[model samples]
Target: MMKRLAMVFVGLMLIVGNAWAVPDGIWKNITGAPAYSFYMQTYVGNAMLVIVAPNTETFWVFLDADDNYTNGFSASQDLSGAPNSLSITFTSDGSALANMTLTGQLPATYNLSRNAQAPSTGDSGDAPTLISPADGETIAVPTSASPYSMTWTAVTGAEGYIVQICTDNSCTNVISDDNGDWTSTGTSISLTHATAGFDFYWRVRADLGGGSYSPWSEIRRFHVSSS
Candidate 1:
């Protein structure tokens, strides 16, 4: 009788373990992001998942290649619904996932391959703010100085910045500024190449370590009084 009890206990433990397993694998998006798609990706240890919304603005978390909905790697089966689209929050370095609502449409059945390509760049982080020379401020060009300095607040996770100064507000006409399209480790840069006495538009974007970049800060317009 004790032997039989022991056997049952072992079986129960196996069942519980299987029930609480987190799938550790790579899941690819069979369907490319739609033109109207809003997709998000999260990295959980060895597992990487992408959440995509192809049809509506409302977003959903990852749907495994086997058509199983991964509830943010949690062992929970409950899914929450909300009117607004869902987004995934991640820990620094893009490891460990969180803040998933788990309420979105499951994609049609698709095959998910295990342990594919490693996670590439484009991880999430807070955006950097632009500062200095104040927005829309006009600085008189020094009589004989060849360059003017621009500055911005440093971003915590950013390793460098891509600065663009344009002749137009839209940044289409790239101004001949320092090392045009230069990536700077410091917050400030001096532009010796741009033409003086013309109104110019400038913006900066943070390079979040890896190839990921924060959205460009609001464009600031500066005027160069003729020397």
Candidate 2:
């Protein structure tokens, strides 16, 4: 039997323009392994690529544009701390090709076709409820102490949760955000980079997979005071 390998490759590309040749949405593999798919979305003036695979390690990379070009982009990074690289190209047509090279494996190409437009918003009722460090709550932090714990009520049928901490109530300035690897199945996470004497706003959303996410929970604020 052949070995089955799964992985999610997420790349953040900083580009200069509001237009893109490739549509932003979920792209399914038309040729090659049935497990390969890509989800592209534009966030905060950057393009984000999300590869969804089951029981796989997640890889993230930041790619800098090499030239003033549109319609296609490529990036190389180590997957799961392995010596592997991937290059993807998109065409004017609703199609894409991904070339991947993995250690001790033959190079392969996967053909992808546009599936659907990226989701704009998720169901509000599926949103997770914030639990810990309650709204307007004050927490004293010592110079040497464990990270602040942020907990929330889990949502049924949710594969994972995304926590975003911002500097404003409107969540325009996001300072910290974590998706918990999409398989953690945990309802809480620790904010290790929280600074003292500052107000932080946070919210939680459920990741329903297939490029769909639940609406963000109500914004909550907390204060971190120096001990």
Candidate 3:
């Protein structure tokens, strides 16, 4: 006696070894991107050699690192559809690559219309912010106890502020340049560094991000215990 058996295959939903893929040739389409993904349908066929399988379908798709498609399968795709091109984007990790995959197998020797411009930039990242005008007080100049003061324009995006003063023309000099004689006052930015009898140039810029620095201020000038 003969016996009957059943079998199962699954997902990616890919048909494999059966679906016809267009040769790696150049297909063309218009270029640009909308806020989200877009679609285009081009003939994926040879016309002379094969006919689309009855009730068969074709798709163009992209995938992610997890093998998930960026855009899903399209329904009612026809070999005669026009503007067979599109644009898309993906994450850096490729975990979300935009694609154009076709299903319902195409006729052998068919073509996949491709957009001249592949996908470009992904969704915009988190909004940026400005952080500092910072906290400080008692910014002094032309004094012995302390010397060095800086003022910055008001900031809007800034969450807070940071003020730095130095006795040198070049700002490359850090806190060490401020010397042991220094102080801060939070809201209104200011500082005083002990550098008696020396002419020091200074300036301040508002930092507009959470702990980020703003563009440096025009180098302002001042003196410590004046010459």
Q: What is the C-alpha lDDT of each candidate?
A: 0.47, 0.51, 0.32
Model 2, residue 162: distance off in Å is 0.6
Clashing pairs in 2: none
Q: Report the C-alpha lDDT of model 1 over 139-224, residue by residue, as the tens digit.
A: 76733375567888888777888887787888888755334466689887876654557788888877764224566788888777
Candidate 3 regions exceeding 4 Å error are 1-150, 176-187, 190-192, 210-213
Listed per model in order, the count of residue pairs whose N, CA or C atoms clash below 3 Å is 0, 0, 26
What are the per-residue Cα lDDT tens digits for candidate 2 across 1-227? Answer: 11112223454333211122322444544443422233333232353434443211111111112211133333354333345454444333323332232222234444444444533221323678899989999976623356777899988768888777888998888774354321236898766656888998988887766444566789999999865
Per-residue lDDT value at 18 in model 2: 18
Judged by lDDT against the true structure, how good is candidate 2? Answer: 0.51
Q: What TM-score would candidate 1 get against the native?
A: 0.47
lDDT of 1: 0.47
Residue 175 of model 2, lDDT score = 76
Instruction: After superposing candidate 1 on the true structure, give the runs of residues whose Cα lies further than 4 Å from its correct spot.
Output: 1-123, 142-146, 176-178
Best by lDDT: 2
In terms of TM-score, which candidate is strongest? Answer: 1
